[model samples]
Target: MGVHTLAELTTFQVGGPIAALYEPQTHDHLVETLRELWSEGEEPLIIGGGSNLVAGDEGYDGPVVRIAHPGLEVVPAEPGRIVLRVSAGVVWDDLVAHTVSSGWSGLEALSGIPGSVGAAPIQNIGAYGQEVSAVLSAVELLDRYGEDPVWVSADELELGYRTSVLKRHRGEPAERDAVVLTVEFVLTDAAGLSAPIAYGQLAGALGVELGTQLPVADVRASVLALRASKGMVRDLSDRDTFSAGSFFTNPIVPLAAARSLPEDAPRWPVTPVAVEPTVIPLDHYTGELPGYAPTAAPELVKLSAAWLIEHAGISKGFRLPGSRAAISSKHTLALTNTGGATGDEVAALARFVQARVSAEFGVQLVPEPVLVGVEI
Candidate 1:
């Protein structure tokens, strides 16, 4: 009931104050509250776990909304499948842990990532070869401009590499005008066996070959250990975890640009998997099968942003003179608040890193967080 600041709402822990805070405890209440606000010509700043946000020191001048409706229900699932419907406000990691403990075959590889269920699809959050899109089936959302609440297929969101239609980036309007209310996932019930491993690092940690399937619980344990070692998993006792994990996303550039960087810079070709040609029965065969030449996609490379930052004269744990914000000592991709750091200081550090990286390799790093009232 008293004053609450964005610092308290976000992991970054450095914003001024909110004009008003709304925490709806029920799904119906959430919709009702937002509609009422919209009717009154007020659009609140909506937040969930606040893991991927960087607010300004001056803070948001408008009202803020935090979805607090708790839901994690196992609904009707077809044979060999598990259907779990999660409310927008449910803690994402809690869902993962629950699934793993219940012998669910999916969501194990995504352990330790922060934020709420509603946020997962917004960023298409992926880690250790498993993406939320792989299991997500549909979502229910409300259109801010009075579009009726409806269920939309996951494909409608246009999920891609760390971006989705719902995500507002660089202060631009979102492609879609809707707020997610809930999400539905179709998980597997493969006798507790996980999906095939696709990440080399995770495989190495699990002491298995790539594409090996292990117990869901084991995979979850390994993922949690790996994340904790890198100071990525949030822990109250660790100052290194006081951050919005991974301040910048890995940069994707043309192969030529990638090759121009130091040979040691880690890079992987961005290639899509080939789709098998469709087969038709002899009696039902169609003529020619429609000969069409697909346009060739130019070769692009995904570069290691951490490697670039370290090589561009920015070391892990580097901090500006007299600033409390410092790059995390354990992870180069993260910018952490040592203690009492301001949002402006964080932005300054981010801009400095951007300038140095661009000057060194001509690669512009894109920030991963949602910025409010701050320019970087």
Candidate 2:
């Protein structure tokens, strides 16, 4: 029962000491730990890199299970389809770099986001106009209520924009509990060409048509470079990188409201059912637009939370008087611990930004990271 502080495990460099932490190196050991804990009436919280989590300063009182399982196998199930079975505990960007280096195309656009591969499909991670859901075929999970692992097709997970059934709760009419052990992605033999470059910047960088394909390695390089500029890529020495990636899911608003905003309100067609709103309104004379925009419609519009934060007068490194927690100096969306901060201080900073954004824009900024022992 080794113990460590959340500060030691998470990117945020905050949080108190956990009661007990267990790292299972193999699947059998992981299952055994779970079974033994269950027999003792303990339900441990599963953790990976702790990138997308905000542990309370008080820390978790229960057992913490860290999945250390590792393996990546490329199995050819058919002539053109290759199922890449990746352990859930694998660091995500490392896997992306690996796949691209091997001439694989599907995972390129998701290049630089932090956290483990196992946590990717939980929210169907997306960036630069590409999402993991498009390539995910199935997931192998250890049912919290059952014994053996079962394979659930992508459809069963009900993946959505930044959401999935695993994230949604079950039982309590909204409670859902299932631990993902491994994930399989179905990749195509594209002969070094990347997936159709749906994102505009990416397409521009590759100097190809929107639906055209470029070399997979080129696409990966471009995506990584772009992410690094925004502080989205994790850098241990850069305090700005001490975050859970984006702090908020881009808000998807109704098309009518989007259209009513201004002729230049940034918008893009999302699904056939919805529109995505970009934070930089086309008519936004404020000159405060962020780099990305949404391109969906009818179902919802994507709006940048970072844009809203700045628009609400919260600038980079904004902090309450005498508070150690502050907004990232390099990125407006991330709330960082400059030094000597606590969970409560971080939560306070998040609340201040949330309230300011909501009051100014009439749209609430929902947090992107999962909160443990604290409410945002």
Candidate 3:
């Protein structure tokens, strides 16, 4: 079979061709194709909706497995709690719509995210204060090093802010050689009520205070509207939404480092819990009970990426000389393809932005998308 170009498969629309692109329509076919590739000494690149990926101009020469199997089943669980076993290929927004329409609440905040269910847990995808980890039950995974698929609990994924065990960090291979076959989410019925609005912007839009619960449908609508305003919702006619959303993630810095920045910089504290005193064994005790010294928990602060970019002198719609790539006019965080931008152009722009931010604020911005054969 002729392969699809990464340009043809990715949201960035700037990659070169691949040796093969397999879109398996069934779970069995997906597994069999992966196994065949592995047996042939090929480690296939798995792609979902291609929303959170960036590929290079040189292109990939190996098999590219695109998970397209679609299924969503409601598993019976305890009352007021619903469990959904969703296939990997299920469009993420479609799942959100289904849950909201069914009077579910947990996924409403992540309404306009463009990706597949399979990709969500890989990054512990979150928005508007609601993360996938809040409701994830388990992931059905096909371990590349094991025989059959197994169900790994959510806690095992070690989901953190926009990261997980399945995610590959910069300059590192994927931590886990497993493919997500399905994801199970345990959501609340909520009796048509949405989860508490934790983000101030979202809360204001809903005309409620933080921790207030509105209608699930209303919450979805407000979130979609907010995302559209920021050019996050995908639209074929809108060039501002052409790029992968949020090129750089909000950087998490320690409290001391965060304080070094200007006071106006947007910052949010990630509070740490109090640590309990360690118990000493009688045989290992060296002296009297340890002095009642209280240790202050380390404080983590999330600095806004968009703020850093703007402060670094890269304004919205900023572009290099004669470069086809530019920052999105609607959002500073998005590095857009103005028109006919190559992967190299996009990567160069990303590196420029990173250099500017790092030089100005001493904060190195990291690319949020999974780059294939490309470095920024």
Candidate 4:
């Protein structure tokens, strides 16, 4: 209904007050405001849970449209499939918990991810080998360039690992013009059976072979517990949960580049051409050349950013001199505000980590959260 500061909305608790904040109670009001803003040449930022953003100390100069539009309707579109049209403003984790409690099988593994449903497709949120894109049927969007609300198929989103067309931009302003209003997902009506377990840890916890099915509720519980242990779950009391989940997307490097590492480096396949390695650093040690040399080939490899941070000698609770901001003591990836920290302080810690990781490993780490008025 009205405006609020970034410090009032975001989990980080460090941004300056926003210029304007709007929470439209209905879709029609949202469309009208958006259309007016677009016609007037205003580019408003669409905010959801404010969990995945890093607002600057100066805050946003533009209008901040909080997507509070609400609706959740389920219709049986076909046998064994239920079409769920979820409003983008719905709290994402709440929806997952609801669906699992109702015996639905699709979103159990995504149980504890913070943020709103509307923001899910913006990055195709994924974890534990299951991605929101896998069950996504279509998205309802308010087109910035056009006058009407349009329904875009999943194919239109160009969904991939932690990315979508909305995020890529592709040299056009189309992404900025589009605001997701609602999302549709196709879920199964299986009697308590969950989607096939794909992540190794989940499989081991369930005591089943990879790709085996278990009870949907069990999968949701296991996923939540796993995330909490990593400080991924949002908890205001715990400074570790102040982060925007994992700070970096796993680096996808070429297979040849992966092979150049010592025999002890851990790796997993992203594709036939790419392999992702655990975050451990290979260049921490200064030494003479081995039998293998670093390759220049364009093979793709995915490396963990957290592992690189630990290897760079930045252990948990790492602080810069006398700063109040420090890395989360529970998880290496999270940079937390231990009270009295400013946006600049948080950004400083992030840059320090990135610089150290890159210097020690020869690999650059890209931040996962969207930055407001600061650079890392």
Candidate 5:
């Protein structure tokens, strides 16, 4: 394709033109294409759904590789569980729908998240009460410096609160050089019952207790409805839906910083889960025992990013003087492209929000999307 328009490729619809584009639909083809590009001294920008991405208006000069595989394989597993090997190019929502329809119970709560399955592990995408890491088993990825694709266990990805080692920080390359080709999800067959409801809003909508488990399909429907209410689920006619979901991740700050906010502001304790204890045989144990260790102080707290933006004086639907980019009318966390918005305009709006939040609370807000050529 000559002079591909990146605005049409990304969900934000804000990028300019691209000189080279490569769309690969199969595993071998993608690997071969990357090999050729690498041999030519080209480090192509790889893309999945572009749902959580923002590209600059000037556009990119390098080659672009868009993963578009459409394969979904059912792996043999023991009874009471299901293993699915999905192509990285498969749309995430479709997979969720399929799982729900097939009575697979793990991914129902993660229903409306945008992007392909291949990109899911990069950010450990989560919503409602469920996250991808909860169901993910492993990913087959190609290590840039290695020869062929290899399966890496989910634990190796270092999944944590909307982040993973596979994800980039501040426009930098991912710490890991691997590019995901396939994702394996291990789902449960718990009589088709959904996972326990963890989100308060979701529980209220479903008319159930916080730990209640409903039918998997019911959970998927409720999650989709919840996302739609926030302008999260895509609707072509709704510009508010034309966003990269939450522009900023919920900021995790020190407990001291959180205490500085208003009394009514939403604040949640951030507790790190204890790792599994190592086991030692009685015969292997030495005579001397270790000394008592003090417990780590609870110092980190998660602050609501939306609340910070609103308290900083930016409201939902807030727009710059002459820019088409604005905060979502339905959700303060999202910055939307209200038709014909340039990448620079969105970036400006994002920077303004970040600056305002920082200036007000002395806490820096970080962008959540994978920005390509766009700076915030």
Candidate 6:
């Protein structure tokens, strides 16, 4: 096979070409390929479905490794629990559809998301009040900075709001430089019943009260419909779908900072983790041991990025004078490529939105996509 351009592989369709592309058909082959790349001192970019990427116009100079290991197996587990081990390359939606059709319940709410199974745990992908972290049991990953692959529990990944130890932040390397080879999910039989509905929008669309449990198939259909209406599901005819889903994550800020926003602004409480202190020897202690107690601080609040963007005076469909990229007409959170848009055009629009929102609300919006050679 020939080397393909990043635009040909990604949903955004705006990046430059790759110097080389390799798709390993099996898990062993994938591991070997990665080991070889690392041995050769090539920091190859590992791309899954390319749904959450924003590559720069000036092509990637390194190798592009694509995970192609495919298939799923029902692992033997405790009674009443179904453990599904899925290969990294399996299409995410296909897995959702299969599970729903087979009467499995846990993943029905995540219906139309675009990406591979391997990419889900990296960001702890969530929507409609459910996260993959909730169901993920373990992951098989090949450490880029280590000598071999290993299976780690989900808790060890430190899955949080749209982030994981495997995800690289703006200015820091990933805590664990690894490539997910497979994922194992522990789901209940549910006997055809769906998990309790949690998100208000999903509940309203399903005509059910929050916490109500509906049929798995019904929930999948409703979730898919809701996503499509928001221009989140992919559609070739809709330019709005030509985007990296939500461009910015909802900002999580301290309670005081959140309260400064207008009363009409949308906000949700985020639970905080407690920090433990290091113990010291009694003999090495200072003159007096300090008496201390850990009291819970005000809960963090997650503010809506879309609300800030809209209230900041950037309406849906807003675009720069010379850019083909524009805010999605159906959703304020998305910045779409209206055919032939370049990476710079998308970056410019994103920067414009960030600037406007920050200037108006005093809140800095962070992009959600993984940028390759593109800065905002």
lDDT of 1 by residue, 340-362 (tens): 99999999999999999999999
Superior by lDDT: candidate 1 or candidate 2: 1
Candidate 4, residues 89-160: lDDT per residue as tens digits? Answer: 999999999899888888999999998999999889999989989999999888778779999999999887
For model 1, state the Cα shift of residue 362 in Å: 0.7
Cα lDDT of model 6 overall? 0.91
Pick by TM-score: which candidate is best? 6
Candidate 5: RMSD over Cα atoms? 4.4
lDDT score of model 2? 0.81
Which residue window of length 10 is worst by lDDT in model 3?
288-297
lDDT digits (tens) for residues 65-131 of candidate 5 = 9998899999999999899999999999999999999988999999998889888999999988789
lDDT of 4 at 73: 96
Tens digits of per-residue lDDT for model 6, 86-117:
99999999999999999988899999999999
The sequence of per-residue lDDT tens digits that candidate 2 reaches over residues 156-200 is: 888888888887321121134778888999987678888888988
Error of 5 at 32 (Å): 0.8
Q: Is candidate 1 or candidate 3 better by TM-score?
A: 3
TM-score for each of the candidates: 0.93, 0.88, 0.94, 0.89, 0.93, 0.95
- Please give the TM-score that candidate 1 achieves against the real structure: 0.93
- The clash count of every prediction, one per candidate, is 0, 34, 0, 12, 0, 0
Ranking by lDDT: 3, 6, 1, 5, 4, 2
Q: Which stretches of candidate 2 lie over 4 Å from their true place?
A: 168-175, 260-263, 272-299
Report RMSD for candidate 3: 2.8
Pairs of residues at least 3 apart in sequence or in different chains that clash in candidate 3: none
What's every prediction's RMSD, in angstroms? 5.6, 9.8, 2.8, 8.5, 4.4, 2.0
Q: Compared with the true structure, what per-residue lDDT tens digits does model 3 show for residues 27-66? A: 8988888888898999788999998988899989888999
* TM-score, candidate number 5: 0.93
